[model samples]
Target: MKRRNFIYLTGVGAAAAMLPAIPVFGKEISPEQALEHIDPAAKKIMSDVALNAARSKGATYTDVRIGRYLNQYVVTREDKVENIVNTESYGIGIRVISNGSWGFAATDKLDKDSIAKAAELAVTIAKENARLLREPVKLAPQKGYGEVSWKAPIEKNTFEVPVKEKVDLLLAVNDAALKGGADYINSILFAVNEQKYFASTDGSYIDQDIHRIWPTFFITKIDKESGKFETRNALSAPTGKGYEYLNARPEDKIQTASGTLYKGRYDMLEDAKQAARQVGEKMKAKSVEPGKYDLVLDPSHLWLTIHESCGHPTELDRVLGYEANYAGTSFLTLDKWESKKFNYGSKEVNITADKTEVGSLGAVGYDDEGVKCGKWDIIKDGILVNYQAIRDQAHILGLNASQGCCYADNWSSVQFQRMANISLQPGKVKLSIADQIKNVEKGIYIVGDGSFSIDQQRYNFQFGGQLYYEIKAGKIVGMLKDVAYQANTQEFWNSCVAICDQSDYRLGGSFFDGKGQPGQVSAVSHGSATTRFNKVNVINTARKI
Candidate 1:
């Protein structure tokens, strides 16, 4: 299928899923070849070559990164394997500050001569571009550890798992979906491993091994007589974990009125079966009534809202209008943050931007730059507090150090400010989903993320979900279809009247959150408990369209 058609069918979040064949960014390699590891000492030698070359070329500041990226994908239909892919990319990227401007160059060749040539080229480019600089770039001070290494706490490296095993799992998931009532089903397992080594003019050398996995499927149910159909997508969240994420445990399953929700781990086979059943129910569900009502949003559903509204708006680049060409700028202007009293949400709403949360996609020992990673409050007790900033932008916020949120999708890409794991902190008051639902006289409970659209400014928006259940007189009455909600970002957050406590808190995220001019993707997680918004607008999507 065409790439655009594939993306349209599966949502942009799973950009790599169900493709006939993945575009090879690097050389196609066998799964066994992916297991081979390069010694950190060897990488350090290559990095030193670039660092010295750039300094010799009159670069005031320089950093070198040696990256080895590996990916594996398994795609299956109802009973057959559609595709199996394994690819590897190895390269060195050198960044330099010369003549008060930034320049970068990358080369796939790792030899000392090639590395030095790339470094000198970077410096030359910086000097040529410096003529157009309005002002010299100012970077925040960063104190880095001399030598350090960080690895994901993965129980099993996905590359080590045989391709046959992954194929077996996905085929079984597809079979379960078909057996459960799906007319058509598509399943995929995608795994990524990034081995990165960094060396900078600053006294530091950093080595990091990052791993991520996503297991998902799409199931469709049809009514042959009516020529009507309904679909359900997997509720799994892309996570920065190993294959162990698919090893769902009894405790990982949370039973609720709507259905079973998963936490850190997932059961792909069981979820596919549930999706098959849910799709059939969706086909027969009644259309929702169009009106304002209280809304209870599951974490699986709320994460996208938080990502589009809260996460994007607070990006330092977007706020500064640097992203105006692509995703547009944010409504959360610098002046609002300067006022310090601008209420961004209800008092119960607390949001944080973190890069250190365990199991989060953005979790890292240090950012793409050499700065250490940590967490900071973005919204505190309803007030705007901070924005995600990098080293170059830290001084604008009057901070001495970066928040450690910089990243580049690949070694060939230039590193820039990216969103961290932005999450809504759970309520302090003890509460359960059932208890929270009991207080809502009239509401709709939304589960799983779906189609969403927000203004470029991340203000006004509408969002749809995978499943919608109506609540009446504090009890779930029945399922509802053609459901979506709309509201301004600030107004919606302020209307949050209740949040279930920590026990119900869960994470939902995307493996590909796109940004920048050339369009780079980053993985991020958003955490929240079941939350309630009062008197929000709910629309019947069928009638509105």
Candidate 2:
């Protein structure tokens, strides 16, 4: 069979072979098969060698992580195409605990001498810092496991796909948008990742494989008469999948000599054209009068709202003050979780932190610490219920097990608690976006993701979107520009009047979600339905100064 054919067949075959092993409804590999990929003997040897060296040097505890990563990036700007870039990196990092201080070092060379030297340097640094320690460090309790591994579900390997084909496809999308009336179009659809993780300590060992892809496109409309420009973008959420995801996009096409085949490409082009038209209309749009007004937010806009307010504030690290220096702490302190009746929204508001959602950027079978991923609630019935927790943080809060939120961006970085798929549960009623708009006597319909800003506390914020339509007397009049909505976290959630049903819910996320003192970037997703907020304060962008 051809390489592509073999890849496709392997995917199908793996799904069948591992079906019985996976506990989930949809999974491609069994947990055991996933775990078997790691060599237990190698892990044991590495652990013994590293830990013994640390102990001999008078270190208290030690751990090592060996990792390999494969990356590919392809970008296209209008007719200009760039060559696909591929890179491979592998390294091992050693961490040592000595005299109540922690020290770390990493090296790409995996030779025995190099590993030993790295270990020596880590211990030496720990000793040097010991004198500055004010207190002895004590870690939260965790039972050591012998061996473990996890594999994220994927249908194809993005690395196997040709760079020329990827660039061609992206340029085609740009060409289509330009032909559809965009004055200037810039777009990129690229998938760049393959991760191999290995961790070991005095007793525990873990191995994991992760895959990711980020695909995006943007179209801008420029009006020379007014010197004004507006832009719109596709809501293609990054995912923990392969090139198959690009193929699965709602808009994909190829041309043949016979005749023009629709192949769903027309719909994508139509969306782009409509977006451009909206931007053009907005060039002459009047500013929204600053005041409280009933607002209906589309899913494209609502996802980011959820991310800023609910997602960041609910991270246990943020609530506990660990993320204060980088992003500041949250108002939702650990003490207020169970007792606080946070008025997040009406009774319809429900949110969950899950790592199991398919296509989610944060989805994984097991976290970096070898803890199995699972789901939990962040908000229930408009009340603060729980916060995302990793093993150490969970133990600190008197919990027995982790919520599986532990993750490290790279093998060289220390594992920290990170966000998962923080999704807003859809409403019970099957209300459509149009239905929500019809009920509104006067409001604005917001669409697509755009620029946004929020205070450190995740409270006071302003959000802008790709396009806005003016609605009067239960009807969309036309597009509007220079518009933004501002509100406090509590006030905004309290203002939510209604939310659309499951059909309107969609996934959205960021590739570089920063957190921690040293700053680690983790990918996460936010799923939301079209939701309405009452009496939100809208402002004119030009009038802000």
Candidate 3:
């Protein structure tokens, strides 16, 4: 039995006390209440037909995932010019296993006929693939769940905000950057609100809502004499929130907040100009020599390092080669699960996979398979400890239950194992970025993520950053251009000599993270503190190119 279900079934009172907001097992929900948000009749028909269809088809395992996604986009070049785009999509995907092979099918139309056809197609595909099956599927055991509903934290729905207002905000930011001496400026802001419902044969049902937003702007400076261009961007973190995010002023009062926050009335434009000047300086900065050097990496750049090296490789499915075609395989093979000490970093390096973090893009109360999300360690005391797993993957690994990592982007995409918010646990000392740098005699300080390349095995990699600064004699000298750092996964982490405390941590992420055979996109966040690596190779990107 799953620990949660066991707790609920054995001690209802304790469970209720533990989760006061969650509905107890066998609790009745009126049809009227359920119908207010979703179509009860349609849901019941779809669930019943999926179960019967899977059983009649002689499939060993099957599940149905339904997703509804709504998205809005607003773009602006400068001034009052703007463009707005909106979309709504929903569909159902059926996944089945037969004769030790897997198959999937999806359809946008949700009716009895379509649902049945999808299920039949899924089983048929599985049967065809079964002929070439190599190894039989083994699922980790999990307690069956009947029904569950979860809502991600959000203040207001982005859709509820007016379209014109969103555009105006983008224009305002563009104007701000342009006024700051930017020869050209471009800006875009968008939001995605998704509603997902899932049901499986093993008696699991889940309903969840997730929200995400990305607001970005770029300012380009041109040298009239040399025709050289330099670009800078505002660092606005993505969040699981609504339109209120755009107007989140620490202290201000305005009835019509549209386009007001981004306006250059405060320090926003000044900061943009400063960043642009820095970028311009970089165009003439000296190239860094390739050699072993001490370095300080800000959270912006460190996030991607952690993503490629730690996040993808730690996925149980990717390590097992189930996700080889899309996201690539992992170096952390199954044999190293518990025995291998994956020397990730110094003793201060602790990492975790969490889906319950508030305001995180990957934050979900319950995963697609109705598994309650929580925290689990990926690395503890510089040693590899666990891998991110979905229900089926967990079963194969002999885990009694999943860590709630299963997810699908939309109804059409089959649920594949996905990433949560993989984060580095902070150090004990409250060391600031300055403090870490003060300790370095000669090094570089890197900020913001740039282009990156990694091997298919995710072992060797090189990463560039948006901003680079030279540290000479324990102090920042100036900016540096064409900078990139290269290191092997183990070698890089092993070189970690220092790390900042929790106070220096920040969250970073990608809006469209791709994975799976047919291609599915998910949004995930990575949070980390500023960190320092010792005796790492730094190269001039211009020379390498």
Candidate 4:
């Protein structure tokens, strides 16, 4: 339920009003402060206390996580800065398996006495919950890797940048949108840093520091005569990098008449200007005719589709009905995967789940449960080959090792299975975006994510985008307005006619992908080249409110 508004920000002033009643969650460290509260010295001492307590409580298994999460957001609309927020959340989450049942508890107190108590309580809860269990949890064998550490390869710490610098950049982006013809503009910059430490009875201690950034804006244009309005969003991607992601490196730039799209780097001002101009065209563009048309999807537009239709559906927990109360159960079921012949898509579609991609938002050295992360195929050459699974879910798939896709959004939440960076592999041969467009005789080209809706099962869906262009006889003519594409998940992916080669690959992502009962959010990226889907259903959505 995240909206593009500054009203949701409770940082500094009102944040305390939102926190659940709990003991000291962690040290209150500002964004400008060092990430020292969860240092190895403190983590080791604290972890040892919890581990010893759990083992003494007759628990067969236990794991603990100490975390410090920091976030800063700069938001602006039109000519003024709407809000600038800096906030932090820190806590410890403890999980234990007793009587072959899992139980979890979390507390903000970082002291040995508090953490040990939490651990013992978790074991007691696990024992109690085991009473009605029909089947005991079967965990796949895991090896303890002793102590290990990993850090995001960021050139600069976004938190280290001055607040004024970020505010000025966003204001400039809004100004560019206004000058470029947008009647209204709203821009935002989101930055996050997660300092996490995990320890378990498996004899492993893991430490990881991760960072992510996203710069986005919305520009609107109004047609005075008809009083109709249109909006376009910035095509910049959210990446697992630092402020350097916005540095606008020449190598990361992709130029076109529609404007510039970024890969590894982003130019906020240039994109805002592009969105402004695009929105104006959309206001003047012809309304689309309801019909079947080929859709040439840029990564910016296709990522959300992949994230929803592919990533969510393939989650093992969703398929097993564990998340049915929150996110609906998956259409992809055991019957589909056990057959090993389920065609999830066309041969051009090779969706893989990865946590090791260097620049991906989901990239992590290890999952919260201390399982080492790696890459695996979800849909290999159109076949439903594998599904994302954690240690507890791996035995169900007849696998001996976890997929290492487990995660917790914050320190206070228990670790659970989450989606990895699921993406479409590019074509084997060399292909360009231009050449792919030339092959489409009558189609639509869509860029940037917009309004979208999918069914509870992640099957049927309708998606809209920021920019739309009509392709006629192998060329892009003028822009089109009031356009959206609807399709079934399997039908859409199976319609993938061709995929552009690696040179055209790029990324698009979301800063807040929501799931779970209490509703935790995680950031993730999807990568693909220019992909073509034949004869997708397109509809016009131009009704006035």
**lDDT on C-alpha atoms for all candidate structures:** 0.89, 0.68, 0.71, 0.85
lDDT of 3 by residue, 63-87 (tens): 7877766666665565744445555
**Between prediction 1 and prediction 3, which has the larger TM-score?**
1
Predict model 4's lDDT versus the native: 0.85
Top candidate by TM-score: 1
Candidate 2 local lDDT, 312-423, one digit each (tens):
9998888888888888889887667656776666677889999988778888766766566788988898888889888556765667878888777665666778888898
Q: What TM-score goes with each of the models?
A: 0.96, 0.83, 0.85, 0.94
lDDT of 1 by residue, 1-545 (tens): 11111212232222224332333356778998999989999998998899999999999999988888887878777787877878788898899999999999999988999999999999999999999999999999988688899998889888899889999999999889889998888788889899988889887899999999988887777788976778788999989999899999999999988889998899998898888888989988999989999999999999999999999999999999999999899999999999999999999889999998888888899999999999999999999999999999999999999999999877887899999999999999999889878898999999998888899999999999999999999999989999999999999999998899988888888878889977778889999999999999998888432
Candidate 2 lDDT score at position 437: 81
Using lDDT as the yardstick, the better of models 3 and 4 is 4
* CA RMSD of all predictions: 2.9, 10.0, 11.5, 4.4
**Positional deviation of residue 66's Cα in model 2 after best superposition, in angstroms:** 2.2
Tens digits of per-residue lDDT, candidate 4, 211-329, equal 99988776667777876677777788889999998888888887754567887888888888777777777877898988999999989999999999999999999999999998999
RMSD of 2: 10.0
